[model samples]
Target: MSILRLPARQQVRVLLLSSLVMLAACGEKPQQAGGEMKVPVSVVTVEPTPTEVFVELPGRVEAIKEAEIRARVNGIVQEINFEQGSDVKSGQLLFTIDPAPYIAQRDQAAAQLKNAEADIRSARLFADRYAKLIKANAVSRQEYDNAVAQAGQAEAAVAAAKAALQSANINLGYTRVESPIDGRIGRSMVTEGALVSAASATQMATVQQLDRVYVDIPRSVNQLAQLRRAMAEGVLTRSAEGDALAYVLLEDGAEYEHPGKLLFSGVSVDPGTGQVSLRAEFENPDQILLPGMYVRVRLQQGMDEKALLVPQQAIQRTSDGLNSVYVVREGKVQPVAVSVGPQIKGSFLVYKGLNPGDVVVVEGFQKIRPGAAVQPIPWKQAGAKPGSQPGGPAGAQPEPEATPKG
Candidate 1:
């Protein structure tokens, strides 16, 4: 069987046959050589659960009550009684105006009142005498009438003096400016020796009640209308009487420890922004919240009893902006279109196109194609090590295996 012993044509034919056999072997598919192709993937079985929906809106902190301290009388500021940025009580004296002029005016009014009282006593005695003399005809009728008229005029002057005295006393009391509310006071706008007057109404300081604070949040009018429509359609549920709960996120991204209650939602939209205003009340005993500070408010709008949730990573958006998810159906990969709602934590609320008990691939979707057979594995979080199984022991059944497919 030596090629050298054979003829040239036979040698050429043998070489050609050998080359054809090697090419045929190389052309065979790898899967056919061993077994059917199966892509390994992680999946989660969909389930319906009660979920709470929250709307986050930008808000600003405001004082529950704000009072502007102003001078009520014309006088020079003699002293500032309270330290700048200190807490003050209601009716506590905050400033003292020079009381010299007011005191002099009050004394003058008192003296006038005393003189009027002396005149009143004299007039009463004269009127009594005139009445008796006229009855007895001891004095002429014209003389008696003139005496009675003088007494009445004196009485009228006394009444006017009394009113002037009261006015003076009131002005004297206004010299001491007091806090109208119990709150933290700001810096003094006018220092000692500065002139303040009632006519101009000079601002002395500002006080704001800070034990409880208000958070004013502006929400889009369109968004609010959509939420109402959803509620009417029975897609959302809320308590008819009680206010919704709220939580605050500070500017630095830290959440406040205490929760708040929504006070009210505005009925009218703002003309400038077309937004509805919402207010929440929070306990700020520590003064952690200050007026005009910006914050984010998380308001619980409503609850959905039957909500479908999926991991955010499992959702894929195509070039056309259509959202979709890949699911394993009948041991093969399948693509499904889904309508997603607001994001809840790390998951999204699935609104449409997906049913409970469907196995959706959360990982390894890139390795599988439509209609391709896939070996579905339990989906582990990103924190888990590669090849490690989720859930408990190896004997534990996966969620998809335990749940009855719809």
Candidate 2:
């Protein structure tokens, strides 16, 4: 019965089977259709972030509160009050010179002052008697005038003695050398019994305040011009108050925990170095930042009024060694070569070849090819902080390494 069902095609099937066997013998797999292909990938979406763009240059660290402790009065060092390299507060005594001589001078002034007071008392009594006698005609006018003049001279002498006493007290206080700043003190230049002078060029000890420090950075004119141009051209956004943002980085690959302000920029350019001096201040509550520690500083060109940005991983170098990013469009991957200028937040400021709403592939970039379709997801959903994170693992990842970006 089955044979009868296949009867119409039995002869035709026999001839076709003979041809297929011959083709199989020629060594080829049969032509197939309805193939299933799937690619496993993590995808990220692109979004715009208005962040300040800046360049980082290597900088030298400095202390805002630094002082060299020197003696104000010439004397022998009688006491060393502080240990070397220890922290000291402002006005704290660090060295006590031989104060016996100052104390003797103070005592002599005190003795002189008492004598002046006794003389003034005697002269005042005589002057009062003479005034009464002069009116009663009991004493000659010249004698009465002489008594009054003696009282005036005694009063003047007392005033001069008091002034001398004050001066002596000040000199006595100066015998103790004190620190003018709160900071770590260096090794003492003069030990106990060593003679020091008020006019010594070398200091008795050096104290540098590290609690608050300054990092002096040199900014090039070309770099400043680039930033200014970006702001004027509306490439950089303005903050709510319209000021640009700033960031700092320390040596050993650490980003400063706090954001800094651009304190001031030198109006004059250095002819020798061809750079302008830029200064920024930071609070060092823990006193961790030391003076003379080299660091790096970054300054925003300006806020990109409505800047467009994308994940840095989305960018790639093409075979031609040009910057590029892969974007998804019409259910296919399209390679886009962009002119990326700088990074803002966790993304980059694309100068050309990309727009705000474009779907750029941030994840699975290595496996993606031209014309390949991808799934798009929100970038922030992966936990990216604008300008701070770039090419890092998505979602609460640590900030990317910012190495003096220009």
Candidate 3:
């Protein structure tokens, strides 16, 4: 068995046979690698369900009603009846003007009326005496006529004085200013001891009703038209009652607790921005929403009964603006073009090019290629593999090793 003892021809034949065996083993290893390698991917089964579509837009808060308090009479402001920046009711006294001048004028008119009444009594007695004298043929007819004329003049003077007294009384009542509406009042504009005049009435304060507030939001006219077209084509269904439900999102991303209803949408569009105004009413009993505060409104536009939804991460838009998704069919990965609609809750509403129960690749997309055989696994967060019980198969097993040829 020693090498030196073997013949030359025998050694050469042995070397050739060993080299052939090594080459066959090397060729078989590559065949196993090319045929059995399978890409592992996570997939989701597509399903149809009812989906709600919402439109978010910017808006501002407004008070339901606003009133400006003004002075109505000419006088000096003697007292402020209500506290500044406090809630006030209709007919509540807010300010008091000095009433001394009006009172004095009223008293003078009353005294003049009393004097006129005295003169009327004296003239009536004289007229009666003249009438008796004329009947006795001792007085002239002209004298009796003069006495009757005097009595009529005194009656006219008494009527004038009474009219003056009425005017004074009205002016006296105007000294007390009252609230015009029930609302929260702003700071006093004119303080005590300030002169106010009816010729140019001074604004005393402002009162605004805040129990119920209005939110004015602007929406693009073009977008609204598109929505209407979609509804007419049966792609979307509006609420039966016509009005949409609305919610508010604060700047900090907190949602308002109370919901609001759409009141009306403007028929005319703004020429500059091409947007239509929308108004919504919300119950703001707590006064949390202030006028002019910036907010975001989530308005429910419509609903779709048979909507196909896919996670946002699964969608890919090519450079040519074609949207597509990777789908797993019969253990093979393939890309399918899809028509996507508006996004709802972090998912896109697939309008076309997909069917129910289709497996969509949600993860491991980078490791897969078109027409490649893949091991579809249930998608989980991150790359953590699903745990398997002891002695149980984790996933698809590797292809059985090829038997060596003789």
Candidate 4:
């Protein structure tokens, strides 16, 4: 029946029902369109690539050569020769001790030697005369033998006097304290007129060579074992010569200008710490590296031929210490658990739970959910050059990774 021909009350009721149906239809159409719309996200395609494997560890700086200047003889310090905190050469006079007593002893030894020489000459002349007389039967054989014995005793006295003189001279030389090495000397321990003794071996000063330095890093035994196993299993390949390069970060968070090389790995493990010592030599011509300074060292040990990596931003860390990333599969997002190794550049080295040709979400994380449709786009990092790869060598991290914590 036509609404116009119905009763007034019924017509009003029919019009209200029609209005409600039209409004419901309008809402349903928009809801269906929203479900069909896909969220746009930046992603990266995973591919196997070669990359250097390194570990960053805490290390201490040490001088390449160090020497303690000590008193070698007992004497009063007469003068301080070298300036405090100044460079010194080998054999350079650093301090002068009281030399008067040593000088008198040397003179006494010289005079005794001279007297002994005179006695030896006179005794030898008498022995020569007695030998001739005995041959001519003018002197008794016993008398000639006594004369030869006296000459031999005089010669022995002369030799003893000469040795005494040499000893005195050596003691005199010790009065002038000199540097044993070429290095920078620290403050003097004793001032002028201060008594120093050889018996106690009093330390006078310190000298250290700063042109080069050694960085000592300790690695846990477990880490060393893992690294060895990786190499043995062909998971990581070392350089042809088995050599490695080392770089350091200063305390101020600046990278050291010069690079260093591995010196040696200690064979014995430290009983107290359960760690092995590793030393690397670095050129410190500017003397920027001081002994006892703490630093972070990046040691490149091996290469990963077919390594998988993901963007640092893409990895999500949970409160339980688990790491995961969003991966797009068949135009849908899925959460995947991954085992991450040390961070390299701006990406993390993936050890597990990722495969080649996988698309990983790098941006628009908040808009994504499990099984949600997504429109993946190539991820472009801020400040990155054109055509640069995301989370690749084109980007860098502010700090090096501490491998132990990873």
Candidate 5:
């Protein structure tokens, strides 16, 4: 059955069939050694580790000591001694009020006192002479009584004059305004020659102690209750230091260089916000922290002796806002729902739905589906140093579900 020995038309049909067969053979896909291609993924074996837990809350910076410099007496501002926005010492003269009027009042009071003293001396001398004359029967009893009454009135006048003099001296002293505390003074509210009044309590400046600042943190009452419950249940053990240790983060996201200590927790809750106030103190020798600055406080709430942590990237959220992770079990991909808790160091505390020894994929999950076989590999964090150990336990990875940014 050689095609070359057949008729010319049959030979042509054979040649066409031969060409079709060769094309089919060239188009056929080559068979691989393995039965199915497994998707390569990075994974981490879940393991329990001892870790510290922290709670972060919004806080406000406040000066520990604040004083409003106000006018204590009514007068025209004669001088401003300290520079604006400069450090000041206690009892330092900050301003001077017009002292001319006060001085004149003081002098008048002194003159009145001297006059009252002279009148009292003359009245007392007459009263003494009258008493001696009465004993000797040299003057009428009625005249002696009148002299004694006149001496008593003079003495009362002298006392009133002394009180007036004291008041005048006090007023004179008020003309020289001084700082009551050691702190940094703000801008002068009143200029030189400006009229200031005691009645109005006109503010001249502000001084605040900035060397140490207080961080006021307010947490909702509900949150405090939950924390208490956790502590009671033995789920969260309070730190031995309690609220003593604290860390602050600036508004610009930079961590403050110095650490702080908690002062006290408010006994009463705020009626408006139902929040309990907490205060912490931090050394601000550099004066970087200013009053009213927005900051974040990190407080160590408790410790979990045995806890499971998953990389933040491995946790997946669905459209309805449920969290899950792709776990590799028995060489097959499985989407397992997971319950997560507070995050620490780019990893989340897995409170539920995950167990020790579970291989969770951290990368390359997009290419696979449920029940699909995968080749799990050590998931190395990007930008890691050369020859560094992989991320997480044994290194996990993720796929179509987006990898969350740390």
Candidate 6:
């Protein structure tokens, strides 16, 4: 602690302190060139857009008109004219019962009718002769009365014979079995030789009209209240189109070509599932779509007048389920949270946290940190177009975790 020392060690300490002070004064400045973080990124323009929103529901294909074809008379099946599972017109003959028994009954009735006519002719002659005899007083009154009684009995016999013939005709008409409606018939339940009755215990076969088919979908009852509230606020509207358009996706990942129409909505909610039934109708000319086929329907819900769109690559969900995006401005990265809407065209409808003029960072995000300096490149020319495709739909899958080329 000596201030002024004549010793050699004291002078060496003073020279060392002076050298340290001079070096500190000449040192590098704060915020030097190497301190800045650099990141290469792709930028995309955020535009306010008006887009369509769709609600997806699971549904199964169904038939609009279905029925069980049955026999109306008791007889053995003599012939079957219609093919199994083939389309048939109304009143088309499907099956024919044996008409032999009915024919015999009809013939017997006709024979009795002819016999009655012959008896009438003889009775008429007798009655006419009696009348003449009575007028001339040539025959006894008792004989004339007997002839009149016989003639009246013959007339009653003729009427009874006519009634029998009419009943026979009706039975003969029942032998022909016809289709009640135009539809596609299922396989024949009874073979050519099987006997059927008007009152059979089991159904013969089923027929369904498939050209105009129905589809039933189930949705939670909670959606009803949500829809009503939306309508009151003018956020939604009851579809004016009688046939609200619906698109169907098949099991094989292909979409059904023609759109369907919403037909009816069930009033009663299901107690078990707390779901309501929604019915729709479609035209199936090719008969390719069948009942019970699992499908996804895209129901057009409503449209948004002003919306924001963002590509899929630009948004990422954090571990805590918060949606975050990295935006680029003046070669700097900023993380922002956004609210997303329905997914469409491999992109999302951004409802909040973005504006029309902001540039969003799409690529090189994993390597950069918040507030890091970045080399921002326009998305279109930086690389391949983002959100322009699905993830390898038909072809072989691209290698995962591979480094993308610059």
Question: Which stretches in model 3 have alpha-carbon errors above 4 Å?
Answer: 1-33, 102-171, 195-200, 240-242, 315-324, 329-342, 352-355, 365-374, 380-406
lDDT of 2 at 319: 86
Per-residue alpha-carbon lDDT of candidate 1 for residues 75-157, written as tens digits (9 for 90 to 100)? 99999999999999999999999999989999999999899989988988998898999899999999888888988888888
The residue-by-residue lDDT of candidate 4 on 107-154, one tens digit each, is 999999999999999999999999999999999999999999999999
lDDT (tens digit, per residue) of candidate 6 on 159-215: 999999998888787788778788899999989899888776435677888887777
Location of the lowest summed lDDT over 10 successive residues in candidate 5: 394-403
All candidates' lDDT scores? Answer: 0.82, 0.72, 0.80, 0.86, 0.83, 0.74
The C-alpha local distance difference test score for the whole of candidate 1 amounts to 0.82
Best by lDDT: 4
lDDT value, residue 369 of candidate 4? 79
lDDT of 5 by residue, 354-378 (tens): 8788899999968999999999997
Q: Better model by lDDT, 5 or 6?
A: 5
Better model by lDDT: candidate 4 vs candidate 6: 4
Question: How many residue pairs clash in each candidate at the backbone level?
Answer: 0, 13, 0, 0, 15, 0
Q: Which regions of candidate 2 are displaced past 4 Å?
A: 1-49, 137-143, 240-245, 266-276, 305-340, 343-348, 352-406
TM-score of each: 0.80, 0.66, 0.68, 0.84, 0.81, 0.67
Q: What is candidate 2's lDDT per residue for 1-406, written digit by digit as tens? A: 4444576679678778988999988997678886434333444554555455565666676888789888888889999999898999999999898999889999999888889999999999999999999899999999999999999999998998898898889889988889888899989998899988878643799999877678788877776776666566666545564543345676565677766676888899999988999877778877667788777666645454454566667778888878888877876778887877655445666677876677777777666678865655544535546534243211112212322122
Q: Give the C-alpha lDDT of model 5.
A: 0.83
- Model 4 TM-score, all chains together: 0.84
Judging by TM-score against the true structure, name the best candidate: 4
State the lDDT at 134 in candidate 6: 95
Clashing pairs in 3: none
Lowest-sum lDDT 10-residue window in model 4: 397-406
lDDT of 2: 0.72
Deviating ranges (above 4 Å) for candidate 6? 1-33, 103-172, 236-243, 321-323, 327-339, 352-358, 381-406
